[model samples]
Target chain A: MSFRGAVVTFPGSNCDRDMAVALEAVSGVPAIRVWHGDAELPADLDFIALPGGFSYGDYLRSGAMAARSPVMQSVIEAARRGVPVLGVCNGFQVLTEAGLLPGALMRNASQHFICRNVKLKVENSQSLFTAGYSAGQILSIPVAHHDGNYFADDATLDRLEGEGRVAFRYAETVNGSARDIAGVLNEAGNVLGMMPHPERAIEDALGSSDGRALFESAIRSLVEA
Target chain B: MKVRIHVSLKPGVLDPQGRAIHHALEGLGFEGVNDVRAGREIELDVDDSVSDEALDAMCKQLLANMVIENYRIERVAA
Candidate 1:
């Protein structure tokens, strides 16, 4: 069966096309574009992606308004049913605001909008998203965001680390994310959220092929499973 | 009935925007400004019969992200 994926687009989403292109290029399966107002997703979706962009113009709080959008209810349901979901950058913020993941993305400690290629170490390579990478292997992915600093309480942070739910860690102090967490996996390992733009790094022409493995890993897992 | 909700980042939570404002004040030679933190105020106009439960639900569900912020509701005389 071909890997089927859907990419959600909100009004202010700028990276939806990039995510679709990346997914199509890697999986050889064109991703269905769904709007935020759509009540339901296309059936039989193997994966769902929430691409990075300033959803709802980052009103109220980043991702705060988008999290309560109509389509997120369906996305939440699909996630609970074990469909793999990847949320990147603003998408990561949406996930945290939606309570699909722990912690909140706060303003950077440096009070500056950071945009650059940052080194990240794959911490848990067993998840569907990171399975293509070797454990502790470092990859350069581009991160661009103002509110990328991840914050959570001590106990929650400890639990996430103890359960091996941390999927990626910043090799350097890119942001003041607690414990240098760059990406995380849900308890079931089916939902992954990160602040970097993996979709932007998928092509060699984009100056990096590091993110190709992530898409390949998802497609490979879907086919194998 | 009128309700005013004050939502604020909890103490110790890093507030970069607030800190930036503080720095600007210090740069202007303002003294005795011990601290500064930013917050939001939400005013709600609801039916008099709306129960406290509904207001609490509104805050918990949307107005305040309980993860890093705290919210306090005040009843304002109309």
Candidate 2:
């Protein structure tokens, strides 16, 4: 079966094309482009991606406006139905605002916009997005954001850790994310949100091919399942 | 009616902007400044018929992120 993936684009979303290119490169199928104003998603989507960018010009809050967009309503419903969803950087903020995931992304502790390749250790390799990586493996992915600091209460943090929902952790202190959490999975493990841009690292020419495994993992599982 | 929605980070949440402001204030030779936390005040004009329940709902649903922020709604009489 052919892989079916869709990339959602909100106004001010600059990385939507990159995300689409990465998905097509790996899945051998062009990803459908969905607009934030649309209330319905394309049918039979096996995977959905929310790419990084300052949605709504970071007004009110990063990803706050985009999270409430019409398309997100369908995206949230799709995620609840077990369709694999991947949120990268600003997309991660949207997930939290939309209540599809836990925690919030705040201003970086350094108070500066970060744009560089950082190391991330794969913490959970059993999920649909990380199945290609081995547990404890470190991958270099590019991150670019000002408000990528992840925050959650202690009990919620402990619960997420206990439930094996921490999918990736920063190998180094790149951001002030609580407990160095770089990525997380929803309770069901079908939804993954991360600060780094995996789509930007899908090729060696892009400085690293480490991110290819993420897309391949989703495609591999959908093909077999 | 005029409504002011004050949105603030929940206690214990790190406030980097507030910290930056504190540093700037210290640079200006100010003393006895213990701490600084930043918040937003949004003003809205709505009909008097808009009930308190709806105002609270608006704050909870969109004006505030329950995970890390708290919002208080205040109505100012015209």
Candidate 3:
């Protein structure tokens, strides 16, 4: 069976198409386009991606309005059912606001929107999102966001670390995130939320192929399972 | 009833916007301003029939993100 994927596009989502193309190129299957207003998702989806962009104009707080939108209900439900969910940049903020992931993405400590390729350490390669990378491997991914500072209580941080749920960490801190946490996994290890834009780095023409590993790893896990 | 919700970042949480504002204030020659922590105030004009529990739920669930912020509700007499 061919891999099936979906990319959710919020009103101000700018990178939805990039996410779609990346998934299609890597998984060899067309990704369904899901709108934020839709009440449901396509059936039997193997993966769901929340692309980067300023959803709802970053009003009130980044991802706050989009997280409460109609489509996120189904996305959250689908993620709970063991379907792989990858949230990038603003999508990471949405998942946290929707309670699918922990912590919050506050404004960058520099108080500026940072856009650049940064090195990340593969903290955990056991999850479906990072299996293509080995533990301790370094990869460069593009990060562009104003509200990407990760914040959580120290106890929760300790728990996330102790449980091996930290999927990636910035090799050099860029956004003043607590403990340099670049990405994380949900309790079930099926949902992944990260600030970096891996979709933008999938092709060498885009300057890096490190991101292809993420999509490839996920597809491999889906096919093998 | 008119409901006012105050949403403020939790203590010890970094507030970059607040810091920026503070810096701007200092640049303007303001002195002795120890710190500035910014917060949001939301005003909701709801019916008197809305129960306190429901209002509290609204603050806890949506109006405020409890991860790094705290919310307090103030109700005006109907």
Output the number of the lDDT-best candidate: 2
lDDT of 1 by residue, B1-78 (tens): 899999999988888889999999999999999889999999999999988899999999999989899999998999
Q: Please tell me how candidate 3 rates in CAPRI terms.
A: high
TM-score of each: 0.98, 0.99, 0.97
User: Per-residue lDDT of A132-208 in model 3, one digit per residue for the tens?
Assistant: 99999999999999999999999999999999999999999799999999999999999999999999999899999
Worst 10 residues of 3 chain A by lDDT: A23-32
Residue pairs of candidate 2 with colliding backbone atoms: none
Sorted on lDDT, best first, the list reads 2, 3, 1
lDDT of 2 by residue, B18-63 (tens): 9999999999999999999999999999999999999999999899
The CA lDDT of each predicted structure is: 0.93, 0.95, 0.94
Q: Which stretches of model 3 miss by more than 4 angstroms?
A: none
Q: Score the docking of each candidate (DockQ).
A: 0.89, 0.92, 0.88
TM-score of 2: 0.99
**Rank order by DockQ, top first?**
2, 1, 3
RMSD of each: 1.0, 0.7, 1.1
